[model samples]
Target chain A: MVLALSGAAQTLDSTGRATTLGLLGRIDPRARLIATLLFACVVVASHWIPTLLIALAASCTAMVFAQLPIASTLKRMAAMDSFIIFILILLPFTMPGEAMFTVFGFPASWEGLWRAVEIGLKANAVVLMLMALVGTMEAVTLGHALHHLKVPERLVHLLLFTVRYIEVLYEEHVRLKQAMKARGFKARNSLHTYRSYGYLLGMMLVRAMERSERILDAMKCRGFTGRIPLLGRYEYTKRDTVFAALMGALLMILIGTEIYHAV
Target chain B: MHIVDGALSNPVVVTGAVLAVGGVAYGLKKLPMEKIPAAGVLSAAFFVASLIHVPIGPSSVHLIMNGLAGLILGWAAFPALFVGLLLQAAFFGFGGVTVLGINTVNIALPAVLAYLVCIKGVRSSNLTTATVWGGVCGALSIALTTLFVAISLAMTGEEFIPAAKFVFFAHIPVLVIEGLLSAVAVYFLRLVKPEVLGAFEEVKR
Candidate 1:
């Protein structure tokens, strides 16, 4: 389990690789982001199978285009789906409608089951769409894209810095935990355990703040103001335009079908 | 409790996003220029806080630490928690992107509330009072977050009502753990760096 977690951490730390297996990976990050958001909004707006399936297909296509490692991404999706498992178990029993069958004298509703599946599908689709669009880009590049898209400067900087330092803090946490374990700190339902964890967190915070202060001083020494100069200007290419057109067409079909069904 | 995407109905998600935007705006307005680095570091702290799984009952639960965040960051908790949630969703897929707004509101709103409820007490001269109040507010924030998450889920569909209630009850153990964690954290911070208790005040000024 520890090895698996460390491997996951490595993937997170190395999210900036420029290599990709699909054309989507090569598009302007801003455009890819816009398309992803648009697709997600549409996905949320409908519960129709065809529309949801199309959205899923589009997301999968994008992922394939980006040449994302399917197995790892799917593992992540499965992890997120853990909650839906509960929803699936409970929804059938609680939903009031035509009973599918009786379970322990309580009737399971078909409507409830369908709704759960729809939600599950929507969840999976949105996660995949995000993986395809935002997940493929470097964190810094995404921050830059958001900045260029006129997101708040403070928010952009906050995101950039948090991403930059999270791994560092995680390492600090690991070291602290190891030290506690080395000293025979076995976790149990006791005040001693909680307090030990608390001190660990408190110490991490203190260390992080001191580190940030040093970083701030360094930035100031280098003539750093609050605003980080935006990096990596992106120009829309022919491929980007073609991708946008394809996305627009797909969105229209999905929306048109949704409206048609509503009528 | 992070509300994943597609779990909530459209109206709830939209309302959550709108409210979160308001909270973030207010947080930004209160954020001092010099405090930017502190905010970032704390945001990272809150994010990493989730990785430490404390043994609770048959399983362990991670600390959300929104209460400690609230006590230290005040209104700045809004943007601080939002950034953490965003990165978690993007990098780890802990939560979905579309539901970011509601998830932000669910988690950070309670942090803001915890700030209001315990900030004065945490700054008290009496160490015992500060620690007790820190624990109270820490647990209260988790309770509030659970409530918010429950409401968000229940609003999506009636079937979720039982699940919603279960969520709250399920977190009762977490509340106790969080309270203890916050109390000790407060004690430590008071001894080592009392100024952190006043960091938000400096930012507001």
Candidate 2:
């Protein structure tokens, strides 16, 4: 509940945080998909520090290779990262745990505070790992990986179209916002503003839907069969599998450690 | 609310994926060939509804018309909203794949409720009265959807109880917004696309 609404209006499109670490190498769609899979694996494997450490090392290595600048990376965090910070701060005060210190007027609990910190760090790490991969890989290659992963064909096609169209949608949103502003939408900073926003959003949806239907119709007319040749599969030779296996082994070790700590 | 990929536990994700597919499949099987276009358009409407944001507190919000959808499409909105949700997950990450079914059920159930209300209560003679009925049903359905979602999350215990509790609390405004929007939307359709709105004779009309 909190998590969902907290995410609220600012979805991923707003998170244009600059990366501090950049790895060199052009990642195709396949590589990007592989990276996403790998990233998900590492996040789950946080149960084991060995895998996480190995992942952390790979992340740093990838960052250095990518040549990500610190200023830009920090800028990204500063803008869109506040919500994450908000969650972290709130967790300490609200979560049930041992009281650590009284700051100003609030009692900071040790368990809650550290738990929040841990979640925050993990989240940042995941974001960093993704930044390393998303730009490095091509969308096409990743599309192929998804195909092999047995994701639906029509769905992939929809995703391909969606990814392509999102920028347009964002641009449309911007134009609408500007139009609303021009019409004297003084942001009175209240819930009353929600009514106007709601009306505008309703209009926006109708407009966008009309646009999408036209687009779909156009595609169908052009012999679109709801399948896109989005990517070519990269054969995972011994190199890829061995790398994956090594990562898996490391994860087992890390999970072992987390369990030990819990015990 | 949009869920992320790794937010829910694996079990939740797997279960959601299965049910979502199953629901949509079942719904699809029930749709007549002629109803396909209407369903697709309604699905698009459902998807577009989320993109619009209403300003609340410090941020903006948009309509989540799972209620209206269920009102019109009944069980078919299950699949329609499911597909719409899946697209959101991939592109927007509003919610994860695991939580898709949960979210679908949450939103679509109200839509069904609204459908029931439209038939039973919205047939009043007075225009204002009819619209009010629509608005109340719209708002109540959305509130109900949010409540169900919160309850589901608490039942799972994966999400904090506070979060679920806040879902209903937070929807206080959304209810007003959705209720008004549904009435206005239906009103607009009555004026312009009454045929389209009436096309769902199974639910209303």
Best by TM-score: 1
List, in the given order, the native-contact fraction of each candidate. Answer: 0.68, 0.05
Among all candidates shown, the one with the greatest DockQ: 1
Give every collision pair in model 1: A22-A65
Which sections of candidate 2 miss by over 4 Å? A1-42, A45-109, A127-144, A168-199, A212-220, A223-253, A259-263, B2-18, B24-53, B57-130, B133-138, B156-159, B195-205
Among all windows of 10 consecutive residues in model 1 chain B, the one with the lowest summed lDDT is B196-205
Q: By how many angstroms RMSD does model 1 differ from the true structure?
A: 2.8
User: Can you give the TM-score per candidate against the true fold?
Assistant: 0.93, 0.66
Docking class of 1: medium
lDDT of 2 at A7: 12
